[model samples]
Target: MEQKLKLWFTEHQTEDYGITFRVNHVYESEQTEFQRLEMVETDEFGTMLLLDGMVMTTDRDEFVYHEMVAHVPLFTHPNPKSVLVVGGGDGGVIREVLKHPSVEKAVLVEIDGKVIEYSKKYLPNIAGGLDDARVEVIVGDGFMHIAEAVNEYDVIMVDSTEPVGPAVNLFTKGFYSGISKALKEDGIFVAQSDNPWFTPELIRDVQRDVKEIFPITKLYIANVPTYPSGLWTFTIGSKKHDPLAVAPERFHEIETKYYTPELHTAAFALPKFVKDLTI
Candidate 1:
């Protein structure tokens, strides 16, 4: 006699947030179409999508993650003409960048064409902007693309996974330097740092590495439910402009869900612990 497997889910409440983590699921389907990813649904978090059985993002609170990741740096930059997005196969970052009127061209450099296709089908809301004429989607290694591109972009956004598997190289100092070389003199680069609660070491290392390449670097935080620890950080590196110095008048025109001019300013206001780690 063979044993039947079971799946269980647990939910917890924290101050103003609610989280639901799942464990043990029965075998459903084994389909490797594009990116070898899995899509599942949860009672609390809505839909849960996983690439190679690893959790990507959940439906219930994906907006918080996507919005903050894309808007903060785009809003801070006064005029971002040519923008490049690395590893954002889901197109969430592209969607946010298109919201800015000053943006002329947005390019998406994704390693897996399948991730983009899957997101476009299963996650329409997140992948909606890829169809825009302003967006030019490129399927290839973003690191190699950055190395080859010289002074090609005004803003670069790295919406990648954690430091693991193929994404490991993206976090290296060499890659940061290449990103610096790829950007226009006044361009800004922003990448998703790890969660402050679970991966502070990663955050510290990335902050240190980026500081060596760019004149000004800053760390900011956003709350996202699907990610480990539910709190994530984004590290911004700039050559000429400071993210903290956004003009007050610009705030009136920008529309955002989570990141506001006030929040954008406050996001850089990290606590003593985070500040110590980066500095």
Candidate 2:
């Protein structure tokens, strides 16, 4: 029998349980000024990016998270010409934003520049849109960007990491208020609220905070396998538009791998447990 190497990269999603991916190769690992960044090629999920030992995204299933975050609010607004993306250094959100012809300018603010640099080299397909002519990449703090912005963007997407380290402020009530001020009168915003299975309190707290800020607040979900528990939640806050009330004429056929016109409204149909969190 030929000798075989048994190497696996495991993410301790929680203290009790974890997910392990068989490792084919480990490309780069380092501790940036912000967090631990690692790039690995896995036997299962293809190229994998881990931030602070947590699975961020994999080549196999990035479309679901990126599409849901970018499209739902974009479609809800009548015209989203100016958009801001906070902490999506991987550029997946920016890629989806550019898909809409109505977007004239897309601004990306990432506090950690290392995430963008590595993603551009290791995950080009997802990060390529950061270099697009319409995209203006800013390397700085996203929280301050939200505070300084005054009725500037038509849409804002918070593509942040889990609530830890640099992302802690992204989930606070003050940030949500700043987001409301940052948006135009009819603008909308969306933020990944994490998986309900592991963090039900997070979902509940985020929903409560967002509801206090935006006139239209809704919680939706998407199945992202790499994320903890594979059930990810997103909280959408809108000033003058409701995602559930979008007309068919408002939706145009766009090139997408996961999101569709039919699935748009269907995503908002939450289960009883998740629905209770919104209460």
Candidate 3:
């Protein structure tokens, strides 16, 4: 007999940023403690899994999201020897960061250990990079970890989920302050800010929060198929250098899929609609 596929939509709406938000219910044949999971998907973007049946990422595309999130900030730094990744249990972010030869250590702080285990089992392509010896996986609260982290890292990447649930603190001023304190004086920080098309308030709020703490704050955009809208935004906070100021020659040795030296320069060139929000 053929197995049955059971999935139903619970709620769907269009947010202010032009991205579609969705919540779904999934049913499985076996009886499990966690039977249903929330699946978020965007019309122009990719899908994401929240729990058991929750589909966090999508098939249409995910490379752009992973690549841009990791490479942009690492490449911005003159030499990044150590890196920290908060909430990227899937390992895609770590994979990209390890590409840099200068990196000596990569720490992954994931709140849920199951997310990492499940991703490794189900999504090999995305989770494969965590196996690298240089990576140190710490299963705990990122906020607490950052708060206690003695100034050791050169780059910190906040690859967290939306500003809801446990992820709420990751977007607050307090977290940014903790991130600022966790880094070296000249360290660089970047995060996966929500899609500007779907969450303008979030983008505006994060930009405001980071600007208050960092000497240089900038917002950039990328096209990820699994997110709400096809468009996504990443906010970069620098302690002493401008990301856009990376010399063209320095990027030649780096291998990239979505971000080129030209694209890196262009990503910061936000459209007027987005540019208006930062001010």
Candidate 4:
């Protein structure tokens, strides 16, 4: 008898190249009003989540993304009492937010309610904070939510997907302006600006747009294995705070896997080519 060739789960990250993983099992797959959601068990990544055929996060490497997204902006601000998250339905960002004692409340606005339901069930470790008392889960449009808010939140995280479907507006200058209006005078914000390797223009546009709206703007990098190109970029904008000037004492302590006090300042040190995009 001959051994069989195991099937693989592949994501076409771009027209030229794609990534694949050995699929142990597919927990579930379904299409919601917004996008396709999938939970799968993989040999390399253990439990993995996918949205619209894109690799959202995997159990093993999720720490890199969640920690970077949360800590950079949270640490940038001296005190972040109230925080709002846009499109982070998986609850990973919320979990990181609750680690800060200064965060009195974390409001998560996800358009697809099913993403929250399934994430809580399938990705428990990542989504555990959704049930926390300090987290407010709202099923609605993040764009509209940002528009209605006025000087409310101290820190805002835009954990959105690629510029498609519901996330297209999130990458626009108008939406960045809305975030400025929604935040308090000293508020800070960080958004995943896609990968510099493939989407350098997008990163450039986001940095330019954010610079126009916020007094302080900077770009940082994080390596996420599951995301496109492995090298991911985050753009941080602040009304009054500068992530570079954060004092050594400002970073007290936090339980994080990928982020640290030293890395906080180092992440902003971008490669020459990636830095050229911002210039």
| Residue lDDT tens for model 1, 1-279 | 955334554332335544455533422233444344665555556556666555676656777777787777777677788999999888888988888888899999998777777778767888899999999999999999999999999899998887776688899999999999999989999999987766678898999999988999999988785676766789999998898888887654555667777888888888788887797
lDDT of each: 0.79, 0.94, 0.77, 0.92
Clashing pairs in 2: none
Q: Candidate 4 — worst ten consecutive residues by lDDT sum? A: 1-10
Candidate 1 lDDT: 0.79
Error of 1 at 250 (Å): 2.3
By TM-score, rank the candidates, best first. Answer: 2, 4, 1, 3
Please say which candidate is ahead in lDDT: 1 or 3.
Answer: 1
Root mean square deviation (Cα) for candidate 2: 1.1
What tens digits encode model 3's per-residue C-alpha lDDT throughout 74-129?
88888899999998888888988988999999999998776777667656777898
Q: Which stretches of candidate 4 lie over 4 Å from their true place?
A: 1-5
Clashes of each: 0, 0, 13, 0
Runs in model 3 with CA error above 4 Å? 1-48, 51-55
Q: Write the per-residue lDDT of candidate 4 for residues 124-234, one digit (tens) a residue.
A: 999999999999999999999999999999999999999988889999999999999999999999999999888989999998989999989989999998999999999
User: For every model shown, what is its TM-score relative to the native structure?
Assistant: 0.88, 0.98, 0.85, 0.97
Task: Give the Cα error of residue 171 in candidate 3, in Å.
Answer: 0.8
Which regions in candidate 2 have their CA more than 4 angstroms from the true location?
1-5
- List the pairs of residues colliding in candidate 4: none
